[model samples]
Target: MESEDITIKPADKGGGVVILDTKDCVEENLRLLGDTSTYQMLEKDPTLQFMERMRGLLEYGKERGIINEREFKYVRFPRVPVFYHLPKIHKKLQKPPGRPIISGIGSLTANLSEYVEHYLQGLVVCLKSYLKDSIQILNQLSDFKWEEDMFLVTADVTSLYTVIEHLQGCEAIQYSWQCTLF
Candidate 1:
């Protein structure tokens, strides 16, 4: 397949997720949140619902003493994300599916997320440690002890951000803090 007509997605198991026909309809697919039918759902709220939600979250934070006046001042509204896709390098006869990344850069949510990350840094297992660079991982891997007849296996999960159940993951995090021994 031609480069414009094809892309790659990580396999749920071990192979590549190839799209059979890309033809000339890439723009619709690039918007990973949803297709044309979904875009129809985007409508201006006359009641200022989005602002209300933000206000509620901020109020809740203030009540819980989680956010100070200084932090409230620091928050800035985030921009709507821009979407783009990078095609896969290998394989033919299929177009790779692209997923949308909700880039929270320069947004209030991003600031809040970063602030929360500071607290999570002190947790039993830091998410950042698991997401370290390849060099660090390779250096650590050098210390792995192999058994006499051992074989190494590796796998990548597809669409992890979209696939994970967020609420369940939060519960697991709570469980890690409560039941698991560090």
Candidate 2:
């Protein structure tokens, strides 16, 4: 009786590609190098522990006359020592600049609260000083005999916040605070 041939199927469409197992490949390459007498000696010797493989490459290059004594000295000594001693220079010279535009007006108003109170106090003091001078002037003009006849006209600003338009109020507040409102 004749047997049918078996066929293999591919994996799912979205599944990743399969790669070759490199463990055995690397182990075989290491085995080939381990067969040498120098490699065997390097494995036994504690002095040749760190750069055993690099020493083999350097010896091979020297035997091939690809690197001379002078060239190897400069390559392995002077240039490398200079690189170690040099200080690490930063890329950017200075830190980034501050923001180009202002932020919230509310923040500005909040910060100016104390200053505003101080300013109002100063203004009130100045107004009181002026009033005293004006009273003195009026008393002098009235010829020393003080009359009880006094008429004062006073005006009250009602609903100052609500009555003023938002944009105009902001501008006025900014002017009073001596700052730009955002």
For each of the candidates, give the backbone clash count.
Answer: 3, 0
lDDT of 1 by residue, 76-97 (tens): 6666544444434243324444
- In order, candidate lDDTs are 0.58, 0.38
Could you report the Cα RMSD, in angstroms, for every candidate shown? 6.8, 37.2
Compose the digit string of candidate 2's lDDT tens values, residues 1-182: 32233212122222332222244323433554454532243335343342455456557777899766654333221111110011111221122111111232333233233444565655444442345556786776678664589655567543344347769966754564453222
Error of 2 at 143 (Å): 13
lDDT of 2: 0.38
Q: After superposition, how far is residue 1 of candidate 1 from its true place, in Å?
A: 26
Clashing pairs in 1: 7-96, 8-96, 19-95
Q: Assess candidate 2 and give its TM-score to the true structure.
A: 0.18
Q: Pick the candidate with the highest TM-score.
A: 1
Q: After superposition, how far is residue 78 of candidate 2 from its true place, in Å?
A: 61
